[model samples]
Target chain A: MACMNEDGQWIVLMGLLTALGLFFLALIINQSALVGQTTAEGVLEFPKNDIRDLRSEIFDVYDSYGTLHAQGRLGDVEEDIIRISLERKNAVVHFGNDTPQDVSGRDLHPVTIHYNNGVTEYDEIVYY
Target chain B: MVNDSGQLYTMEGVAAGVIMLLTAYIVISTTSIYTPGDTHIPDMQLEQLGSDVLAMMDTPDREGGTSQLVGFVKNGTETCGGNDLRNEFLTNCKMRAGDEDTKLRAQVYLSYRRTDGTVNTTPLSLPDPEFTGRENAVRVTRWVQLDGILPGIPDIEHSSRPRAVLVEVLLWRA
Candidate 1:
């Protein structure tokens, strides 16, 4: 076969380059959509609200410990929290409060709360 | 007479047309993939808003006090009124930047453990007859500590003792 004129072959090369560029752009866009999906899934899975709600509930237990109708039944309430969290939420939760001590001119209990599900683990010591 | 010099330009033009169509197809298909991912964004938003509302409800208006949720749910029906709780919750959820939102509705339930080590869930509010029970509804739950003998729950202690309970709310559009 005889070779034809090669004068405008750069047009074909430029078209090839443009096609490569578009392909990469599509790849990046697809990857970005994946990133967005994972970010939303991560926020949903982290259980931030669950942990916060658990902490507040623990504080309420302490508030009701020696007063109201629950006087002298703190242990049973604590058990209630642990068992329920494990059973319903599929999370292990443990919390305890130390004796009240004077801090900043007021008595405060040092409370430690720990929570762990399969994915997220959180622990905190809060004064109340 | 047949002309041949213009054939190169014709070939390039055809090549350009093909590339443009291919590019458009690729772009459109890639963006379609994005819509499926975008669905999660709305769920994320609803879940976050539901969580924030529940947390705010659990917060006491005054320092060193039980929130309205605790007060209304206390002791399993002593001070807790289902109507009052639902009204309070709806009011909080409906607040918006513009006209008061009228589209949100909620149903409340309480879950506690029985003596047999099983959990029982009871309604804290009357079930809305209009609820269609959409799967898109977001469920937000908070922990409530009750300090009296719960009477309605089956297989639990009848003595006046403190216990932990879960307050769950299903929020959805009307």
Candidate 2:
């Protein structure tokens, strides 16, 4: 081994470095592609539209039928919502409104809504 | 040392390799790489557009005014008002900047609670004549608050109590 010169060794070393650099670049590209995939998957998985639609639907209930409570016919309607949400949406939902409270010289009902579908949980309290 | 003549060749190879790597990086960075998400892209777009249409239909043109969606639901399946809703929805969906999208179509359904305490879904619009049952469709729902008796629905018994109903639209491209 001592008879051989080591002058071309640097060339071999540089070729190895070049190969490593290219591998790193490929890895970086793969990581970037992963980023894009997660973004789209995240948007589709979270039921943003479903939650918003539920909120609006609850508000619509309040608009048509006065203040809601846990008793009488209004309670039955609320039960309908909860049961249907669980069945069709694969989500558990509960919502109700109490007697109107004075807000800025106006009487508005205090409504509360709770929703959970395993992945996400949401709670909302609004006056209508 | 020994054989310094090959040093120039080594230097040229190193330069070429570095240049190629840098060029590749620049080119890749400039263009977008859509991986694993292209399959869901069309579904995402259709869902967004469908939701937008439902939201717009439910929105009142002016403050403290009734929306067209509510009016159609109140008219029920027995009347021509439901037909109007279908027409309006299709027209809105097909309308675009460049040209009308005739391939887009929709069917409407109403979900209501029965007296026995179960939810029931009834079709407000008939099934599409061209529907082969294999087309991919997105269902978008909006809540409609109906006042008093559901006079139009033959199945449901009339009750004086107000109620909330779900209006669902299934959109697809033929």
Residue-wise C-alpha lDDT for candidate 1, range B1-174, written one tens digit per residue: 433357678668667866776677667655545547767777777777877877887788988877877777653433356656877888876776875768777888887876666777777787888897765677788887766666644445687656778888888777
Reference-based lDDT, each prediction: 0.75, 0.76
What's every prediction's RMSD, in angstroms? Answer: 5.7, 4.2
- Number of the top candidate by lDDT? 2
How many angstroms is residue A12 displaced in model 1 relative to the true structure, after the best TM-score fit? 1.0
lDDT tens digits, residue span A83-126, model 1? 88887789999999889888999999999999999899999988
Clash totals in order = 1, 0
The CAPRI classification for model 2 reads as acceptable
Return the top candidate by DockQ. 2
lDDT tens digits, residues A14-63, model 2? Answer: 77867868786887677666645666668777888889999988877776
lDDT tens digits by residue: candidate 2, B80-166: 556677888888776678757788889888877777877888778767899887887877777666666767764666876656677
TM-score of 1: 0.74
Instruction: Give the DockQ (2 decimals) of all models.
Output: 0.29, 0.35
